[model samples]
Target: MPAGTGGSENYTVGQVRELNRQGVPAQVVTVGLDADDGRSEFNDIPFRSLATLSEVGGLDGTIVFVNEPHTVPTKQLSYLILHNPPPIRDEQKAFAVRGTRNRALIVTSRYAAALWARYLDVDVSTINVVYPFAEPCFAEQPRPDTSAGTTRVLFAGRLSPEKGVYTLLETLHIDIIEQDVALTFTATTAGADKPQGKIIERLLGAHPGISVVTSRKTPATMAALMADHDVVVMPSNSQYWHETFGIVSVEAQHSGCRVIASDDGGLPETDCGGVVLVEPDNAEALAWGIRAAVASGPLSRAARQDAAARFTVKQSVNALLNVFAQPAPIPPATIIRQLEEQVLAPSAKVATTSRPDNVLIETAV
Candidate 1:
């Protein structure tokens, strides 16, 4: 279900659309607020929403695929697709157990699958790695700007603490700006409903070279935005909430922009022909890397074409279909035992706090 507009939501929607295109019966079931107003963006695929899994029928022998870990009663044929393994908590452990007991578990990256499997101490065979597709944003006309002037760098994501917004700003303050590079920070502030947003806003307010742009731009517009930039920097912290596959990095490569992403999580997996990798949360390293990327010549035409070929929607669908075709099953006793353990274990409490710095900023250039 598309609960919000993030990597998982985008990946889910894209996979569903591709599957439907391949003549597979797939439907999107959404939970939480409808980010797209319940619009069927996919041409032929159908979508529905329900508060709980019990509301739906014919779950028996049906491969119930879930993006996140949650309790969903299903028949023998079911699978769990995890974009990221939940943090260390009793609920997360229970979710792992449920995932291991399913017919198969699909993960976006090997790193994520390994994390889940290690946490649960289960066989890694149960997990299948299926990288998400990068939405193509090829510029209609190449905007080659090799003037040896201030390099323009773009970063797109939520301005959350886990996302390393503060780290990115700090890197600019210590590195990019110091090197006379222009920084463009674009994000969907809706997800940054935390104190971290205030920190990012303050950083933006103080930095003249840094512009925070926010809006749900269409694919074409996004491609134009990427084409205008020389490089894309993804300086994310290696927290539980880090990038899984980093669709933006692939998109940047597709847009003919050099990508400098953190080595943490799945950033290294988006190897767009030796994509630059920097350490997480290290402003100095990020700064040095940004300077090098800015100084380097524009991405070769071959790199962009290769990225487009590697991360197409059709490839993503085929990878998922291969996972679905696998004949993996977990015994029922293990599921019941895990459920019993969950009931016996103390409930893990999680506290969420919201902050007012979540407002979207529209930069007037």
Candidate 2:
């Protein structure tokens, strides 16, 4: 709930709020997350920490686990929001696949559904895709005037190698880019406490064009920050990490910032107009993309309106509620296995209506 938090976790905070606002009562049930901790907005959202995750087995309700898979079995039907890509290690992958058992899996994008279907050997349709929506602030904030001489560029992702922060460093060091006085660079201190983050921040903060600022604490502030910049860069490293869906890409686009992102994973599925995709992990191509964005100039009013309509919280929340109203679409093989083991309930359902009761969201890291 604070700056530098992972996308999935940040997603949890917003989703729960929207769920509650829609009359679908939801509360965060945490495991070892201290509500008193000022490091995050845990105190802001409605959450209660259990002594252990095993306690989740004793609770009654439709359990909706976020990001990570739940470790314990539950009495009521549970749903898992499979946020990250499958683990690379065979053992980890096997464990993750096992965690999906007896749980309806909901991923964020079509690309994620395909990736997980291949990993789990299930039909892609069985894994639902409730595409993430940009917060209202991103779409509502008026785009800043770029008439100011410098073209502002921002790196909004976490300051880690996987996010291509180091690659961005390489791009900035290029002779042509380094000397281009028209371009001004900025980076958020997302993950600045990590070893790699500290190293990157030090290197970037020392640069003549870059300024490393603390990441915003809220979506409104983040939208304001993005609005000030003419371009947003997301060079996600495709070497191992495959982004299921690039929320930052959508947020930036909604904020009317021309995005220069790597064309990998679900980034292409971001679907918002006005993005300039480049080769993943290539500094030269990213630099070229920045130049391309600068050449294109600011987005028109019509383009901003289209982006605002394309990805809204209302659509996402409606889709999510629809998923809740229906039964979990378990594959035939999984259903057979569960039936044989007497684990499949005869009338298994995620929830009863658009606004279900007893919703508990697990914010497991």
Candidate 3:
């Protein structure tokens, strides 16, 4: 499902683990460029490479759900889950082609389903909307009395520009905001080869007083930490990878923390109540949202109840099963021609089903 151990991959493993618990024969086939195959266990399920699975014919009749179609096989019952808002024209063309080759297309938000349907040049009915879920570990925590002063704000997930880390830093720098609030940043992108991580590092270096919590925590640990915070900020920018299904915001809401997130991508669709939406990449708006959350107090019992009722692993898994039960529709002749002309042109790198390296695993970051 995921190429590496990121948010999407982590969520996939959790869902698969739940599926396996409920008597579903779900196994993880991690598709990456790493060579020298080695076996590992994730969420008590067998984690194998695509190469190893193909050698044993394990892919036969398996419904492969992928976000990155570039690196995965277009085999039996492939469900392409659209996540990234790609900016590159060539990448968009390639992604559109790769998506159509799949048997079914899956999207988390209605916004994504509509955007992708237009981008892929398909009817809106063709795409299925199945919302993402937070693991059961993210339960509500006891809220601190806001009247006592010192509001705690958190920004979790990848330290990338698309995640609005830069915007959060700028908001913190503004002098007009209340000084009673303390901010914290967690999660490290030590292995990710992204410029956002470097930018976050420089920002942290400049503002040493901003707390740095330990990164790379287990689900329970992350949930516990989230429960301690009063407000969680997710100010994802639309310039590059906008906040697609803001998982951290969902987790925070479920954990009894008020959420202040950018109204970009699938973020607005997470209207489960108690979310304070703001404009993306705007420091003033983000600051206002944070301040408003501090004054509003903790999430109401109804909001927390709504989160529990709607955003559960069981609901997501059952929807996925429904999607898998249906038969795949055939691609149109016009779509086939577009794929042949644009995606497989002389300038484009030809894709092959035989090679596992060419198979991309979309992380949906």
Instruction: Give each model's clash number.
Output: 0, 0, 5
Off by over 4 Å in 1: 1-4, 31-37, 40-45, 57-64, 95-100, 138-148, 179-199, 202-206, 239-242, 331-365
Model 2: residue 39 alpha-carbon error in angstroms: 9.4
Question: Per-residue lDDT of 2-106 in model 1, one digit per residue for the tens?
Answer: 233467767777777777778887877665444453454444457766655565434433455656545556655567777764566887677556645544667
Per-residue error for 202 in candidate 1, Å, reads 5.4
lDDT at residue 355 of model 2 (Cα atoms): 35
Query: Candidate 2's residue-wise lDDT over 1-365, tens digit each?
Result: 34436778767777777888878787777776666432345445677677788998998877888867766788966888988899999989877877876678889999999999899877787888888888899988876556666799999998888888878988998776888998999999888878988888888888877898888877888999999998999999999998899899899888988999999998988868889999999999999999999889877778887987876777887887888889767643467687687754454445333336756544422
lDDT of each: 0.67, 0.82, 0.68
What does the lDDT read for residue 165 in candidate 3? 78
| Candidate 3 residue spans exceeding 4 A from truth | 1-5, 32-43, 52-58, 71-75, 140-147, 178-195, 332-365
Q: lDDT order of candidates, best first? A: 2, 3, 1
Superposition error at 58 for model 1 (Å)? 3.3
Name the top TM-score candidate.
2
For model 2 the local lDDT of residue 272 reads 81
Query: Which residue pairs clash within candidate 3?
Result: 68-362, 70-360, 71-359, 71-360, 72-360
Candidate 2 displacement at residue 122 in angstroms: 1.6
In candidate 2, stretches whose alpha carbon ends up further than 4 angstroms from where it belongs are 1-4, 37-44, 331-333, 336-365
